[model samples]
Target chain A: MVIDQIHDLQQVYRKVVHSMSRPGSISNLNNITEKLEDDLPCNHAFFLCALTVLDAEVTFHVVASEEKKARLIEILSSYNMSRIAPVDEADFILLLQDAPEYQMNQALLECKTGNLHDPQQSATWIIESGLLSNISALSLSGPGINGTQQLQTGIQQDFWQRRNDKVKEYPLGIDLVFADFSSQIACIPRTTAVTITEVV
Target chain B: MIAKPHFAFFDEGSKKEIRRATLKAVAIPGYQVPFASREMPIARGWGTGGLQLTLSLIGRNDVLKVIDQGADESVNAVSIKKLVQHTTGVSVTEKTQEADIIQSRHRIPEKALKEDQILVLQVPNPEPLRKVDAREYMTKRMHAEDDYSGAWLLLFEQIMKFGRMSTGASHPVYVNGRYVMTPSPIPRFDNPKMHQSKGLILLGAGREKKIFAVPPYTSVESLAFDDYPFTVESFEGKACKLCGSTDVFLDEIIDPDTGERTHQCNDTSYCMEQLNSEEKVEVENSYV
Candidate 1:
């Protein structure tokens, strides 16, 4: 089920760019996952995002459970021979939906928040969510956003708060991508201010 | 014999690398993301950065527009347009409305860009603090610490030396209210068009090997003191000699025979369009 690397990667990269630029906008990356192995612990869209972003030059750290990490590394290595570094040193971090809140917080704190002069060197988090759209939502407002936008994600309030804390320093912080089961994606860059609105 | 150029002139790997960097740039507005800028037929300091961006993002269906100093026929612009056309065989257009991707050096199009259009600006030096601090690491530290006193100090000195701010081109702007970015070397007159622009603006510096962006609907305010206020290059009563259009930014032209100076619209294509339109139809074009 291997897809066309050059063309598929280009198409996926465009969708990812669209999502990242306009925070909270849903971009469909459906067919990008057509090539992933069937039995992987996580959805294929996340892997599609990984391959589109991470390459031989950039190292990635898998923050999921031990089983998922092993499988994730195996699949990722097939795409590139880049070594997996520790969470703090990794250029990209892949977190599964099942990853504990403590692990999420640890990754948030330990991941490289690039220094002011080289903020572009900061880590980007690609988090997997259970569903694409839900009743509960997260409010986002920042640079790319017109005013404010709201999108549904499976992430908890505590996680959003932790993310906010990490980004208080302005330019030196991690950017995030949320990929869901339906192959829909959303982003929250470090410059964005995020709030998990409670579902009433 | 010279070898034939590859599609878009760069290898697939290079294009992929650029696309990745571009996505990261858009994700984090105004923050300069370093990329492995490839050597093009053009020199580094010219429009190579914008060229790389245009090459990478260009699909077979894209209609490209290239401009230098507001003229599509400028040497730099023509060279780039020919290079891309030769490599990708993509249709090139002078009409701003027809272009999907517009690459330019030092000027934004006179017509307002739509949300679907992408603008790639060629930047000589991406660092706005280069004048204030020579060391890259020191400036990085300053930006990290949210310390931009040096930037303000530089502006203050300009005000002290002259009666008012004298920055004509390459004016510094605060993007998304986060990072102070140089909107390339575009005249201050074009700076206002970038504020919450409908189109996405990507700035690339080939020599510097950096890329950054101002996404659609984002705020881009030029750096100015509360008392001084941000001002664009003014052309109050001046009108283009050819089209008699008074609103657009005008370029001064010397009359060799009469030893006099007259003005013409800096944007050649827009000027041509104006001259072609019989009546001086005035809707107060939103661009100004």
Candidate 2:
């Protein structure tokens, strides 16, 4: 069973990398049941998404509750996880669909960015939301942008507002990505401008 | 060769971006140049930093040498060498002299590198004030503004208690009298090599996604207070058990059976080179 979990974890990681490089794309993970979807506490799946490798030095976070933290600690330890975080110190922020329940503020304060040691090493926020469109609609512009490209994600207004609050820090802010539960992702680097309009 | 992007390892378009940044790094000398970096084949902490720079600067005819702690045999060095060879079919070497570009992890070679030589250092963490100070935005502003009193105060505190600024590896230095820079984790002994040496010095951090440079013949002053001037650590009483050299960096390995520790040069190739040159040393091993 542990072997199966480990193997699935590996597949999830490759998917994340492929999507990031291609941008405006979706990665479908075949392993792991959909039943375990909501049960995933933090972005452990999201963490596993971009994580080609996990060591004692990289960090992760869980701010929802202490019980959640304890459970995460158990799961991460079983995977030989290193550099686990208090949500505040995480390099990557994974927001489950049900997140922002009671602890979003604490998670926000804990994730304030800056440190010349690694300016770009600042935390990245990834939220899993239901897709609202086929993605011929949204447009994104920023540093990674070659020009306006149709960005696709089904995230709502308030979701982006939460991201903007973090984004206002300018060069010192966190980058955001909204991925469908389908694994289709649109990245809004701190420099990216997101404008949602309906396709005529 | 590890089939790379459309043009060379990094696409011509990507190379253009890096080349523009390299120009800024050269123009500004020591300033950290922010770049839109891409993911490379190698892992970050290893030599990804230097690998990125090498990939960007790689031309068809260039000769490259990669060293970790001054030895080419180190696994990380071997891995990076393989990657560069894969992307660009340029000749790679173990010796520091024969190469046009050298990507080094720690120790600077004992031989003086030429002005034509380009040395790239792999940086794990580039900020010197990170552990002691808070705020990355402020640090960049301070570096741009040349506000270094805060860094000095921290060193002063260290001296008051420990009698020396206790930074080992990643030792901070003012590069070209312009920007405060971390010479990656190279030993302080190699710090002098950065001062107006023949080679252009570039630092890269793949995970952090930053690349900065110190131009040839530039001033790089390691931060130090007047009363407690900066000093480089030495092997002191220790000598390499293999080469019997006292001046080299020694790695201490504890013997499990006797609980005794044996010291040897952290540089495997350097030790072997010493044995080969001196008639006094002979063993069944490859040191011949």
Candidate 3:
């Protein structure tokens, strides 16, 4: 069954809002993801998120191998009519699975963290991961969190370190959206303070 | 019969644009995010911003509540609720606790909101520095540089003249210890409700073309001086004439015949609920 662009995307956007506001909370996008056509290079959740937010007004970039990157860009652009841009200029950047440390660092370093005047111009990185699970725990405390909440994910520690470094300056940092193959997603806006509690 | 408007009166593209800006607003806590505001059937400055947000966020499963000046049946609230229901066919309620999305102007609900609920406040001015600095570019720079002297000065002048901070509504608050934001034009009593709130609070300014947010559990402290602390409007010894409730915000009413003054709950739905519940208890006692 094909997804209803209006109805399905509305549901997806609300879930995104839910997870983004609460930071550590996980939202399931399976209902929308399942309706997507197969044979896509990226996770359905990432594509759905892009579709929900992207348009001709915005630009996006995909961090994948040369061939996969081209295909993802073509697919996203064709679907949403959004332009593809370099990492630094992109409004939304998608990091594909098994992205090497160097590429991750480059994307993080180059992505736009808007200046003081307009901090909302920063890029939102949508990272594809193995699974959204309790294999490793992250302690999150900040706006939106009541006291301290634990987030469990399979993402590597290095990425968290890079994220922390990038967000050291408040009001000028990139936001992150992590999605897994199981259609589980979570968001870590720049406001949340993330500390790796346990990595197993 | 008139043709049904595009599912919430906005095309998918417009919805996408608003959603993106809203996400950025949420991510940044209190920082204003600019977006293309669409022209609604209603005129500007008439709850259009909150209506736009409600239209963008509403789904088939959602229940919406609209309030103006704490009254559920006010002209502005009723018009907006009718438009939303006409376009989306979603349920509209007067009960705050039963609502999934509560779009309000000038007041927060007297009752506490749950984690799942969302509060959309209509904002006429999104910039906290607009009053201090007329130039938009300069205000942007001031925000970037963490220069808030003008904001404090505004309050200081009020204190110097009135012997107290006399901001009746739309009190400026420091959000997340980073950006200073206007908590809309909600009364001073409603300002504290934004702090550490369990429900997500999204503010939209259609005329200003800006959207901002206060995520759940976020710190929202009203600007105050060391010598003079922030205080809400005192309703001490004042109770609602209709419900006889003293804890809620009240609206003073003047009787034309005798020139008598009385107070009633500003939140009409809340007052009605209280009256009904009390009546129910009395009826049960009589039956026993």
TM-score of chain A of each: 0.93, 0.67, 0.95
Q: Give the runs in model 1 whose Cα sits over 4 Å from its true position.
A: A31-41, A100-102, A133-136, B1-6, B276-288
RMSD list, candidates in order: 4.0, 16.6, 1.3
| DockQ scores for all predicted structures | 0.53, 0.01, 0.90
Clashing pairs in 2: A56-A82, A61-A87, A114-B136, A115-B136, A132-A154, B1-B86, B2-B86, B115-B198, B196-B217
Question: TM-score of chain B only, all predictions?
Answer: 0.94, 0.89, 0.98
Candidate 2 wrongly placed segments (more than 4 Å): A1-200, B1-7, B279-288
Model 3 clash pairs are none
Give the whole-model CA lDDT for all candidates, comma-separated.
0.84, 0.64, 0.90
Name model 3 segments beyond 4 Å from true.
A134-136
lDDT score, candidate 2, position A140: 59
TM-score of candidate 1 on Cα atoms, chains taken together: 0.90
For TM-score, the strongest prediction is 3
Chain B in candidate 2 has what TM-score? 0.89
* Residues B1-288, model 2: lDDT tens digits: 854444246644455455445533553446576776777777667777688788776655778888888788888888888877876777997666788878888777766777467788888887776765678787777774567887778788888888788877767898745567888998887787787575667788777767887755567899887777777877788888887998877778899999998898776667777878774534544464
Q: A108-154 in candidate 2: lDDT tens per residue?
A: 65684645433454676666656624456566553223345575565
**What is residue B227's positional error in candidate 1, in angstroms?**
3.4
TM-score of each: 0.90, 0.56, 0.98
Per-residue accuracy of model 3 over B166-185 as CA lDDT, tens digit each? 99899999999988999999
Q: Report the error of model 3 at residue A130, Å.
A: 2.0
